[model samples]
Target: MKMVFRWYGEGNDTVTLQQIKQIPGVEGIVWALHDVPAGEEWPMDKILDYKSKADAHGFHLEVVESVNIHEDIKLGLPSRDKYIENYKKTIEKVAKVGAKVICYNFMPVFDWIRTDLFHRLEDGSTALFYEKAKVDDMDPMELVRKISDNPDFTMPGWEPERLKHLSSLFEAYKNVTEEDLWSNLQYFLEQVIPVAEANDIKLAIHPDDPPWPIFGLPRIMTSQENLRRLLKLVDSPSNGITLCSGSLGANPRNDIVGMVREFADRIPFAHIRNVRVYENGDFIETSHRAADGTVDICGIVQAYHESGFQGYARPDHGRHIWDEQCRAGYGLYDRALGIMYLWGIWDSLERNKQEVGA
Candidate 1:
């Protein structure tokens, strides 16, 4: 697995490329244009600009975390055609910059849902937390306000420009059902997979954040069967998955190791992280260590290795440790440590193989 790190561009992020470079085996950054609205073409000059920065740092620009899907596409509106064309243009632009994969999600309104951004852990470190009961109890706007109230930095997915229309956005999806979402996603993949293939860029859809419906919105990209259906939509190698452990693992039945082995060839990108799932349906992001969380970090890595994966992977959301004043769940300290933990698993597996062969 070729490891990458998520970098939210130059000034937008607290973690620096210099710090990222210090992490062993991290080869590139998973990035995006935060200011660019969905459905608009990504500017060519801007794409090359990030390319220049990556070149300067000697880091590969192999994967982008998201080129968000326009809501019209998910809603199956007529305007979605224009948005698909724009997405094709964006894909072409990212390809020019040497990107091999573009990771995007199809969740209706919010990209990822969480009740608390800095939920304190027993060890005093804090991580992203999702409270099941809270999601059902709070108003959607109230939840949005709570998450966006952070004064430190503007949270991703909760962009003010987008959330400004939260009511309308949620209203747009009221009539849409799970089958409708699947059909819309298929329509989208049908249009874009050819473009992605032509550009040698794999279009990887991230699994639904909690692998379930939220706020009465239909979420189809939530399970293995749905994933299988997604691939069959395009029936091309360019059509694939991001294979995020934390996102799909929230359900406790995802069998991440099995998923990795099954979808190995289709997955060109991975979001490797762990989460502690409670019997109450609440969940919290945890360290990459196996013992610290429910997801089998070691087994997942071994499955990727055994599958002969030559794809890009990254350490996903990490705890805020050492009192790091950074983005919620994206502090450099824990993530860097998580990188070492993942690398330890990967490297140890390779060493074990060599020793056995010897």
Candidate 2:
């Protein structure tokens, strides 16, 4: 695995490239222009600018967390053609800057649902938390406000420009069912997969954050069966997934280890993290240690090792520890710690493989 870190760019993020460089085994940055709205063409100069910075730090610009999908495309609206064209252009631009994979999601309204951003843990450190009951009782807009309430940094999916139309967006999606979402996603893949093939850029669709329907929005990328169907949509290596453990792990039923092995060839990017799940359907992001959380991260890595995964992987989200004044789920200290934990597992596995060969 070529380990990467998510950086929000020079001015936008609290964590600096200097700090990221200090993390052992980190090779690249998973990034994007957060200021750019979905369905818009990325500026060539800005893409180059990002590349220059990462290059200066000796970090490869191999992956982008998201090139946000246009709402019109997800809604299957008539204007989707125009946005799809923009998406094609954006893909070309990112690939020009040496990006091998672009990680994007199809979840409507929220990218990743959470009841609290800084849910306090027993250790007094806080992490992103999800409460299932809130999905039913809380107004979607209120949840938007709660997450965006922090003026310090922009939340990835809850952009004000997008959430400004939250009520109408929800209304637009009300009639759209799970099958409708599947068809729309397939339509998107059909249109863009060719462009991705031409550019040699893998378009990795991130699994739906909670892996379930949130506030009645249709979610299709929630399970292994759905992923198999997704791979069949394009039937090309360029069309792939960014398998995220925390997102899929929220639902205990997901066998992430099985997924890592089954979809091994289609996966070019991975977001590896652990979550502490509860009986009440709530979960909190935890340290990468298996005992610290419910997710079988070690087995997942072993699956990746066994499958001979050579693509990029990143330590996903981490708790805010040592009163780290950083982005909510992304703090320098804990995530750096996570990289070490994952590296420990990967290194041991690799040594075992080498010994067996010898």
Candidate 3:
């Protein structure tokens, strides 16, 4: 596995490229043009600017966390064709800058939902938290206000401008269903996968953040079976999965290690993070250590090692440790420590393999 770090870009992020460079084993930056709205073609000049920055730091711009799908595309509206064409253009532009994988999600309304941005842990640090009861009981507008009101850093999926039309967005999806979502996603992949293949960029769809529907939204990329169906939708190598552990792990039955072994070849990107799930259906992000959370991060890494995964992976999210004031889960301290933990497991696996061979 090639370790990468997520950088939100120069001024937009608190963590600097210099700090990211200090993290051992991190070879690249998983990035996107945050300023570019979904459904619009990314400016090649802006793409090259990011490329220049990463190149200056000797980091490969191999993976992009998201090129967010517009609601039109997910809702299967006619305007989706224009957005789809723009997406194709963006794909071609990023490929020019040496991107190998583009990670995007198909979740409608909200990309990922969390009730709390800083749910305090036992250790006194804060991490992103999801409270199922609150999500179900609270008004969608209230949830939007809580998340999108943050002025310090922009949250992915909860863009203030987009959520500004939360009511209409929800209205647009009123008639949409799970089957409709699957059909739209298939339509998207069919049109885009050929372009991805041509550009040598794999399109990896991130599973729904909680691997379930929220606010009555139809979430289809939530389970192993759906993921399998996703790959078969287009039947091409360019059609792939991001295989996020924390997102799918919320359900406790995702069998992440099994997924690694099964979709090894199809997954070009991995979001390796841990989350502590409770009996009440709440979950808090935890350190990458398996003991800290419910996810079998060790076994997941082991499966990747055994499968000889040559894809880009990142320590998906981290707790805000040492009072670091940064993006909610994109803090530097815990994630760097998480990277060490991952390397410890990966290195031990490598040693055990060498010993067995000897």
RMSD of each: 1.0, 0.8, 0.8
Model 3, 296-353: lDDT tens per residue? 9999999999999999889999999999999889999999999999999999999999
Q: Score every model by TM-score.
A: 0.98, 0.99, 0.99
Give the alpha carbon lDDT tens digit for every residue of 1-358 in model 2.
8999999988788899999999988999999999999889999999999999999999999899889999999989999999999999999988888889989999987888888999999999999999888877988878887888888887899888998988889889989998888898999999999999999999999999899888878899999999999999889999899999989998899999999999999999999999999999989999999999999999999999999999999988999999898888988989999999999999999899899999
lDDT of each: 0.90, 0.92, 0.92
Whichever of 1 and 2 has more TM-score, that candidate is: 2
Question: What are the runs in model 2 whose C-alpha is more than 4 Å off?
Answer: none
Tell me the RMSD of model 1 versus the true structure: 1.0
Q: Which pairs clash in model 3?
A: none
What is the Å distance of residue 214 in model 1 from its true position? 0.4
How does candidate 3 fare on TM-score?
A: 0.99
Q: Can you write out model 1's per-residue Cα lDDT over 109-157, one digit (the tens) per residue?
A: 8889999988999999999999999998889999888887885665667
Error of 3 at 276 (Å): 0.5
